[model samples]
Each structure stands twice: as structure tokens, then as C-alpha cells.
Target: MADFDKPSSTEEEYFAREDIEKKRKLALQQADQLAAKQREDLRQLHFMKCPKCGMDLHTLKKGHVELDTCFNCKGVWLDAGELEQVLAQGSENNGKVMGAILNLFKRS
Candidate 1:
């Protein structure tokens, strides 16, 4: 009768090593993808000086709304209702406000 117990020591070692290498490669690929995505997101965030006034146009958070304000011009810009979206993406409440502010220029 043919043996049907378990893999030999050498076979088990080879399979274990192969699995570890595969998992390592997958983790590296995931890390690279995450870094690339972060870079792209950062690049898309737009910043421009207020044309009407010299004051910088800065992001602000009031509740769930993200507004860009120019103190000198007394102007505010909203991202077409992106505040809620930013809030949804936040992992915690602490960063929700800041994340909403920074997401003003991020692409949907």
C-alpha cells in the first residue's frame, strides 16, 4: 500500500520556505502600492494664494464642513460638499477635522 501519512522533513521545510517568501513578496508589493498612493494623493492637494488678497487661503473645519478661508478677503471656499466624505474616511475623531481640512483639494 502507498504511504499517505504526512510530508517528509525536507518537503515540509521547502514548502515552509516557499510560503514565507511568497508572503514576504506580497507584503512588499502592498507597501509599495500604499506609498505610491499616498504620494499621488499629496500631489493632488491644491494650494493657491488668494488672488483678491495677499493672505494665504487656508483650510478650516467647522463641524463637518471644510472651508478655505482668506482672512484678508473674508472669502471662503467649499469643495462641493466634500466635508462629509472626508469625515467618513477618517479613522478617528481626532484627525477628522485636520483630515477634512487637508482633503479640500484631494480628488474624490
Candidate 2:
């Protein structure tokens, strides 16, 4: 014979639900925190300064394309589609591409 008993106490069931809810909330909060940290890291990487002229690199929009430029030397640095990369998935590879392009122009 099986004892067809409801939970021994409603309090225990209530506490169980509360514990589950708490864990769910904590997980959501942790995920939000992680996302925010990643965004901050990307922002730091995307916004750079020109070493030669001491001017902060500025992002500008020309028609539909985005460009990065230095205020002093009028040097334009392109991140090889950086705006799309960052906006899509927070990638930092754009900086490397920009550096390579600039170096190529410098060598010639």
C-alpha cells in the first residue's frame, strides 16, 4: 500500500519554490553582468588614440559607412569593417586589420 500523502507541509513546498526562483534570478543577474563586462571590454578596444598627434580617434559616419579619423594629422584609420564587426559580435580583430593597412600605406 502506498501512502497517498500530499506534501507533509505546505511550508516545505513553498520554500522549495522560493529556492528555485532565487536560483533563476541569480542566474539571470550573472548573465547580465557578464554581458556588461564584455561590452565594456569591446568599447575600450574600439576607441583608440593616435600616438603621433595625441588626438583621440573619432568615429564618423559618411552616408552609410563608418570611418575612424584622427583630428590632428587628418589620418583616417579604417578597421576593415570594424563597425559591423563590433556591432555584430564584439570582435577585436578589426584593430589588427586597421594597423596592417596603415603600415602598408606608411611603407610606401
Candidate 3:
């Protein structure tokens, strides 16, 4: 008579290994997509050239919102609504905000 309850350990292991590899590939694909998206975001940011000198803008984070600064022309760039956000965050952390602003001024 055939054995009724033999464990198919080898078959189970093969399937499990295949599943792990599949998951690994999927994870790698997702990471590549995220990297591509981040690069695109940075590309768009770079396209926002300095109005004064037409150079790439560097980011400066103070309080809450991020501001762009032109290293070439020493100009600060602000987007819509970011000024209000910065002001609101500044009041909440006045000292820290002041320090950040001072640092930006020093850099300029």
C-alpha cells in the first residue's frame, strides 16, 4: 500500500525558494521605481532656475517649508503658501527658526 502521509519537504522547499526570489525581484523593481521618481522630482526642482542669474537653486529648510536659494546671485525663492507656512512654524519654534534664518543669511 502507498504511504498516505509522507511529507513533501523537497517540493515545498523548491516552491518556497521560488516565492522568495519572486518577492526579491518585486522589491527590487519597486526600489528602482522609487529612485526614478526621486530623480524626476529633483530634475523638476533643478528646472526652477534662479530668476536673477538663471542658475540652479539649492534647497534651504527652515521651520517647516523648504525655500530655494541661488548660490550664484544670493537670491531666495519662495513658492506660493510656503511663506505663510514658514511664518506659522517660525512662531512655534522661534529660536530654532531664527537660527536657521541666520545660517541662511550667513551663507548668502
| Number of the top-ranking candidate, with TM-score as the measure | 3
Model 2, residue pairs in steric clash: none
Clashes of each: 0, 0, 0
Name model 3 segments beyond 4 Å from true.
1-46
What tens-digit string does per-residue lDDT give for candidate 3 at 1-108? Answer: 355576488978999999999999999999999999999998887687997888988998765688898878788888999878877777788657756775766752
Per-candidate TM-score against the hidden true structure: 0.41, 0.42, 0.49
lDDT per model vs. reference: 0.70, 0.67, 0.82
Model 1 alpha-carbon miss at residue 58, Å: 16
> Regarding TM-score, does 2 or 3 come out ahead?
3
Supply the global lDDT for candidate 3: 0.82
lDDT of 2: 0.67
Candidate 3: residue 107 Cα off by (Å): 6.0
Candidate 1: residue pairs that collide: none
> What's model 3's lDDT at 70?
88
Model 2: per-residue lDDT, tens digit, 1-108?
254554557778899999999999999999999999999997786557765676797776543446677767767766777657434432345455445435533633
> Which candidate do you rate higher for lDDT, 1 or 2?
1
